[model samples]
Target: MDNGKIKHIGVFTSGGDSPGMNAALYGTVKVAEQHGIRVSGILKGYEGMIDGHFIPLESQQLQKTVHRGGTVLKTARSERFMAVDGRQLAFKSLQDNDIDAVVAIGGDGTFKGLIAFSEISKIPFIGIPGTIDNDLAGTDFTLGFDSAINTAIESIDKIKDTAESHNRVFIVEVMGRDSGYIAIHSGLGVGADAILIPESGEDFLQLLKKVKDYRSEDGFIVVVSEGDELGAELVASKIKELNPEVDLRITKLGHVQRGGNPSAFDRMLGIRLGAASVNALMNGERNVMAGILDNQLKFTPFDSVVKQHQLNEELYGLLKTLNT
Candidate 1:
């Protein structure tokens, strides 16, 4: 609606960092240039927005980074961005720089920022889905999910090696705030004997039953989500009571899953989604998120995109039955 003459725009990654962020930045920059738009990349997520931390971007600034992992633009969660004063400051910074629009690359929390931001400034902004959790509602898949899942699987595989050698029950803990896509996919990918997730919580006794049945003199591998009902250490202790002879260990994958080179799938998807986001902006879709909905790529308002959504029930049930 603005005649596609976007003079200046901004890009920032808010919320947790993940692989493929750099690719998204590259895509956004390249596509914006194609439309004769001047783009600036923001660092440290919304903190950068509040502090006016921006690097004016040119196509050369993002050339050939499509295969790289992590956000070259950098990221941070601004607790500041959540407040009214902070949000106002952020808008001031954007205005000071003459930014006509913004592209936010992050998950639900970041989209919530978009909602607040649009209400305050009425400046056009588009969201590019980049969270590894894949929990964002509007999109079929987020950009970083493939890389994160691969990282989780690799961690589980390595932990299993040690578990088998020592005949110990290894509980590999992965990151998944609420949705269990990562835990479930990684568990099934690596054939984890017992997988625990927040969505499918059980009391200690019930959990013990599953662990007991899956445990053996040869040891076992149990995969747990950080947001699971109980910590892996506590779960291991409970199993120890059921079988005193069983050795146990826990591998908290921690931020390691957020590290490393992004998988090819993530990079390419990030590029396409990033470019599509800019196109969405050109199409007069502001304060919206660009994502794959139903089978086609499209845009949705940030508020709608950030709505609380959960894992596929069918997949959850399948994982439960398979684990049992």
Candidate 2:
């Protein structure tokens, strides 16, 4: 609760790795330096925190990382960190290193872990929404969502080329385990014929009818989020059964969407949110996530941010209208 009690800040990325995470780390380091606060890089997220994997980071260590993807400090999912004993160990590690606070970058799972850790330790914690899913409740857009959508769009564009050449229906699957943000945005961006998301349960018959309607067209593209009711495989199977004579292919754009240089928007968002996280901690904010909502930076309680994000119905309707 005392701002002066925080002299050294620890930062780490956990859960799924995403683009622009390094930019966030860089921004945190640079801003902490400006504020004369020491920065310690916690390698491999909470696992590192438990093992006391501490490294002093300067502004020089963050050189040229803005354009880079992934985290310079690395990331991991720690089952051990979930236990009370493990959290105690993590707190001891922080105390041993003289780290008074933390800036964590990752998705909902990361925040959940931070909340658990906070119950056992007094170190203030600030979270940055750094996930491709864009499924965090507090933020309008997460740090890596923009770059991830762009990556999927680029891959969809390439698949469209071959789909057209072969006069085939390509079922393209994108990441977003429980949300449709990536599928909706990339689907609209690539002008897909139909888009299936987890939020709107897949209607196989409806999809079949749409494909049949577009049969005479040059080619067809259906964008499906991996978490959809009918995944790419099942959807493709149903389509094949309905139209055995139709040329159909399935393309799952897996981890590729999580890599590559972050887009301009993501880089800027990461930097801004990263700096905001440090400022929040210095201002005595704890157990909150730093994010941008309505183009303004803000902090939300960790409990609220970790809740399941509702799908944007307006954007879903726009996708339908545009596709139709």
TM-score of each: 0.94, 0.96
lDDT of 1 by residue, 71-174 (tens): 77887778888899999999999999999888888988888878877778978888888888888877888988889999999878888888888778888889
Tell me the whole-model lDDT of each prediction, alpha carbons only: 0.82, 0.88
- Candidate 1: list runs displaced more than 4 Å: 1-5, 202-207, 213-217
lDDT of 2 by residue, 174-235 (tens): 99999889999999899888898888753455678777645664778899999898899999
By TM-score, the best candidate is: 2
Q: Over 4 Å off in model 2, which ranges? A: 1-3, 322-324
- Against the true structure, candidate 2 reaches a TM-score of 0.96
